[model samples]
Every structure is written in C-alpha cells, then in structure tokens.
Target: MAMSLWNPTKRNSVVLGLLSPRAMLTRWPSQWIGGALADSFEACVDVQRTALRDAGPAAFDVLIGSSWGGAVAAALIAEGAWTGPAVMLCPALSELRRHGAIEAIVDQIAALPAERKAQCLIVHGDADETIP
Candidate 1:
C-alpha cells in the first residue's frame, strides 16, 4: 500500500501508492514521489491478500501504482476487492507470464464488472524501459 497525505491533519482522503519493483528494491522513486506527494504517504512492500482485504474499504480513496504495483492494483480491482478508482503507470501485466499464471490473471480481469473497469486509468509509456 502506498499513500501520501496532503495534509496529515486531514485524513479525509487516502491515496494508495504502488511502487515499481526497482523502486521497491532501491526505495528511490517510491520514497521520492511518495514523500513529495503528502505527509500521509504509505508504501507496501507487497500487496498480500489478507493484508489488502484486511485494510478494508476505507483504507484508500484512490490507487496509484507503477510497474508490478500497477498489476496488483489491477488485480485487486478486477477481483472486486477494490471499488475506488486507479491510476496504473506502466503496469507490468505482461510479466504475469513469469508467474506461469497469466491466463488466470487475464480471466480475473475479464470477470470484472463493467462499472469497476470504468473506474480505472491505465497509462503505459512507450519509452518505459522497465515494462517494455
């Protein structure tokens, strides 16, 4: 989970931040962007099933994810686990092949409700060296 608080005093909004694999290892982009966003920033090393589910509905207002994190965000939304909107930057959906379960993930994404799919925003950079 990645989140930055624009105002620590104001807990009305929470934005989940998903970090890239590289960012997770180095804590650069994650820390830099997350730190600059707001004071309520939180980073999740990994999006585990129990943890994400336990976070409940009020845990985040929106999700912003990069690379692998974006894939997790997409999976969560596709599985009907998350209802809020999402912003995926260079989502590594293609990397699912490495898990030997890309089909399962695709099926899950395909099963998403129309309304749920409508709330997501996916941005893939042509020059993205990581996912590309």
Candidate 2:
C-alpha cells in the first residue's frame, strides 16, 4: 500500500526502497540530481538495514516499495543482496533524475524480465511522466 505517493509500507514484509525526491528536485531552487539520488538511495538502505536489524531473529519475509523506492529495490536486486518477494509501483529506477540524478537506470531495472527478476508486483500509471 502506498503510504504516500512517495512512501509506502508493507507490514510484516521485508522491503527495500529507492525514494523519489521532493517536488523541489523538479523545481529550479536546487536542481542537484546527484545529491537527491544519492540521498534517497542511502536513506532507503538505512531503512532496510534498520528493518533487518529490528527483525533481530527475523525481519522481513518480503520487500515492497513504490516510485523512487522502486529504484532502491532494483539496486538491491541487481547486487544480489537481500531476500524476499519484492513489489514496486510507478518506479523511478528508470529515470535517475527528478531533477535528481544526472542519469537513470530505468532500462536496467526494466531489463530484468519477470522470469529473471525477483518475484514481485510492479505497477505503473499510464499518466506518469517518468516513463521513457
């Protein structure tokens, strides 16, 4: 379930996220894609780590995320790190910059077909501009 358009949580499920930048990333105020991307990526990892630690003896049995978090989820997937089913919606992995990253790995994320990628639930809105 998407907690917000940007953040969502899957209770009792292990999740890794790649969060999107705030709308300001799209605005002219501070259009630094690198920082936003890095920050979001790092924050996501931190959250996952915390969750894993909190799991203590046992944490997540599945992973879930949306938007920018999808990218984070993909990064973990690519690294062959983490375990559990994954879910991504309206992911931003394809486009690194929301005025954030200089580039995106959307193709990389999408490249992994259903057979190759982790068992997951992915959703995309027809009206989204992040699509390439």
Candidate 3:
C-alpha cells in the first residue's frame, strides 16, 4: 500500500510512503482472501524492492512494515535496496526459511556492515507465534 501525507509547511509537498500489502489485510480482509496469496515470497519482496528503488531511498524519511511486510523490508535492506531507517513490527523471518531463502537472507544480513544494520529497529512481541 502507498501512503502520502501533505506537508503543510511546503505548500504542495507530499511525503510518499510505501507499505506492504499484508498491512491492509486486517482492514480489508476480503481483498486479501481473494487472491493476495498468489505471489511467492520472493516475488513479493522483489515488488517492494522495485518500488523502493524507483522512488529512491531519499524520497522516504523512514520505512515501516509489519508482519510479512516487515520481512520484505528487512530483505530489501539486506539486499542494499533501501538504506534509510526502518521500523519492523514482528517481521516473519521464518517465512524465509519456508521459502528456502533464510540462509541467504541471514547471510546477507550478517554480512552487512554494523552501521547499516543499526539503521533498522525490529520489534517482536513475545506472544507472536509466527516469530517466536
């Protein structure tokens, strides 16, 4: 999902933000149930990466993603597609394992320079079965 906020001080300036498709599932369950699960995990991440790259990292002040979206954000960061700050809420890193990409993703994240990893903040709840 894409969101834009008007910047009151800048006349017509708008702050563009990108959110994962899953983020809307709660509010729009029917939309998700219809066909949102067709895409592969990697395919979804690729779409997100392409959008972020097209917008350029400078276009966004920060990236925020939840659940599977959080995983996509982390994957983009690990792949060097996004260098901006990010807030990941209960990222489903284990989903990568299910798709057989966990090792590579983990390796990429581990190989990142300390400074790059520091740009992301991850929050996982103790009660989150997906991550726990």
Candidate 4:
C-alpha cells in the first residue's frame, strides 16, 4: 500500500500523489479470506513478482509504511517481493486482535524467511493508543 514509486518529477508528482491514494481503493482486495491471512502473505509476494516480472526491475530508494500498510510492507519485503530500505511508522500490528481479526501480524513477520528480512526503521508515537 505504500507505493509512492510511480514518478517523482515535479510535473508528475502531483498526479502521482493524487493517484496513489485513489489507488488504495483499488489496491486492497474487496474480500480476503479470514483464516488464511498468514499463509497468503507469501502468496501476495509471489503475485507481486509475477506482476513485476514483465515490468522489469525499477529503482527503489526506500519504503515507508504506516499502520496496516506498514505490516503489509514488512511481509512483502520478508517474502522477497520488495527490495529496499524500509521505514515503518505507527504500524498496526495490534489491529488483528483489536478488531477480532486473525493472528497477530508481528508474530507472522517473525516467522518469515531470514534472508528476506533486513534492518528497518520504525517510528511510533508513544502517545498513540495503537501499539502499547
């Protein structure tokens, strides 16, 4: 969900910013299977690889993810779908339990392949009630 990599030129930045948020509506699936969220994380990475295969490799300066998006980004990187420096801010690993969802995202990430994980940047506000 943290896809700011469309185009960074001044001419295109505006359109890119606007399109990015709009794409969020299109990005997430309408319905995700409830119990299989964990198993599907890697599957998503596979899909990403397939989608990007024909597109060719592109420059990725860094990845910045917030809330649920951050968790997803971590999973994507851990599954080898993305290769770049990452920044996770106010990540929503607790949302799964908060909303009566499935297992915790943090736990899932802890189980990812060691090769896919790398040093990352995380920033969370202490006052934020999300992550205690």
Candidate 5:
C-alpha cells in the first residue's frame, strides 16, 4: 500500500488532493494530517490545466483547495470546466486586472451555459490574511 502513494491506479480508490504549492507534495499531508487518512487514499498533487490535459481522461470525486487554489477550483467549476463537488478554503473570489480587463468571478459564474456550477462548499475565515 505504501508503494501506491506515488502510483495513480484504480486501487487507490478515492483521490483526495491539495492545491498548488503543496499540490505536488503529497507526503506532507500524510505527515501533518496523520497516517490514518493517507493509508488508503491516492493524493493527486497536480491540478494545473497543462498537467490535467497531459494526464488524459481522469475522474475526480471531489476538489478541495486553499487560497489561490481555492479560487482556481471555484473558477474551474463556474466556467463549467470541472464538474464535481468542491470545498474552497478562503478562496479569492474578487476580480483581478488581467490583459487590460477586469476578470471577475461573478462574470465567470454567469457565463455558465446552463447554470452548471459545480456543487461547492466554501469555508472562509474573516481573519484570514492570505486572501484578504
């Protein structure tokens, strides 16, 4: 089972993931969250578009992220890119100036063809400084 941590196979069962910066670093969760949770799960660390495209067809049971990753997860879902349950921790939902235009999350969500926002639960702390 230990060898399966680095391997993405059917045997890994549910794929629980952490977002960028820590996405590719799977071992850290096992150490920090305790061994029990890591015992039977395959940690998918790479969630970037290029990586996802290169990986071919893959199914995710749920998407969980913090900070920038949280914002990414929300954007991906609102854009109808990823269809799955998600949990965003302190997601950055505001707009940013990119390429001389303001990119807002509200517009992204509104753009969904059939209102296909992925089922997501957001947990944000008022005192959080990373996204503030």
Candidate 6:
C-alpha cells in the first residue's frame, strides 16, 4: 500500500488514504489498509497494525478513509490502534453489518473517550443511499 507525505504547511504531514472495497476495483490512487484485499475484517485491521509498526504510528499525521475504509479508520482509533486525527467519508457501517462484519466496533467508536473521539471527523451526506 502506498502512503503519501506532503508539506501542506511548515510541517510535513503524512496522509494515509484507505480506499473502500469498491474503490479498490477502480483506478483511484489509494490502497486498502493492507496491501492486498483481506478475507475478514480482523485481517484488515491486522494489516493496518502492521503498517503502523513498520512505519511508526507517530509517522502519520492524518487518516483519510472512504466508504468501508472509513469504518476501518474509525476502528483503528476506537481500538487504540491509531492515536492521530482521521477523516471518515461516508463510512459503510450499515453495509458492514449487512455483510456480517463486526458490529461492536460502532459501539466502541461511540464509547470512545471524548479526547480521542474529538480527533476524528466523520462526513456523511443525508442523501447518500449506499451508506445512509
């Protein structure tokens, strides 16, 4: 998986972009949490953990996730895997539930400590049918 680093300001920032399963089918310049598609949700998280270990969690400044990837990003923070800021765009929590993915992660996200929860920003559109 490719992780991009850019100097948006005086300080250099590393942005990890996690693409959704559908997005993976496209030619978008993003990657799954793991370099390859995972067979289970836990496998996905494991790859992210490995990435953090290899790259150092502190190396990342922000996490940006789209659709199912958003759910993964939220899980990382909720499970204390990542302690940095994240931007989740239309996380596919409902779709995950439908596909038999872990449901408790959602609760875990809601129950996150205020300070940690504040580090995440979720963007959802009211008219979005896929993730509504």
Best by TM-score: 6
TM-score of each: 0.56, 0.53, 0.65, 0.48, 0.48, 0.66
Off by over 4 Å in 5: 1-47, 56-58, 95-102, 110-118
Per-residue lDDT of model 1, residues 21-85, tens digit only: 33356556536444332222212223434575788878878887787667767666665666788
By lDDT, the better pick of 4 and 6 is 6
lDDT of each: 0.57, 0.55, 0.64, 0.52, 0.49, 0.65
Error of model 3, residue 33, in angstroms: 18
With candidate 2 superimposed using the best TM-score fit, by how many Å does residue 121's alpha carbon deviate from the native? Answer: 2.7
Model 4 / residue 98 / CA error / Å? 4.5
16-119 in candidate 4: lDDT tens per residue?
Answer: 43344443453343322221233233343345556545555574567676875566666555555666677888765565344334344456667766654555
Off by over 4 Å in 2: 1-31, 53-58, 97-118, 130-132
**Mind giving the per-residue lDDT tens digits that candidate 6 earns over 1-132?**
232233223121122213334436643444333322223345566667788779986788999888867877877877888888899999877766664464678888888889888888999999998788
lDDT of 3 by residue, 12-130 (tens): 11221012344254435443322223233455677788888798767889888887678778888888888889999988777555534456777898898888889889998888776
Ranked by lDDT, top first: 6, 3, 1, 2, 4, 5
Which pairs clash (backbone N, Cα, C closer than 3 Å) in model 1? 1-44, 2-17, 3-41, 3-42, 4-41, 5-39, 5-40
Residue 73 of model 2, lDDT score: 72
Q: The CA-based lDDT of model 6 is what?
A: 0.65
* Residue 70 displacement in candidate 3 (angstroms): 0.8
Clashing pairs in 2: 3-8, 14-62, 14-63, 18-68, 18-69, 33-100, 94-106, 96-104, 97-101
How many angstroms is residue 115 displaced in model 6 relative to the true structure, after the best TM-score fit? 1.3
Q: List the residue pairs that clash in candidate 6.
A: none
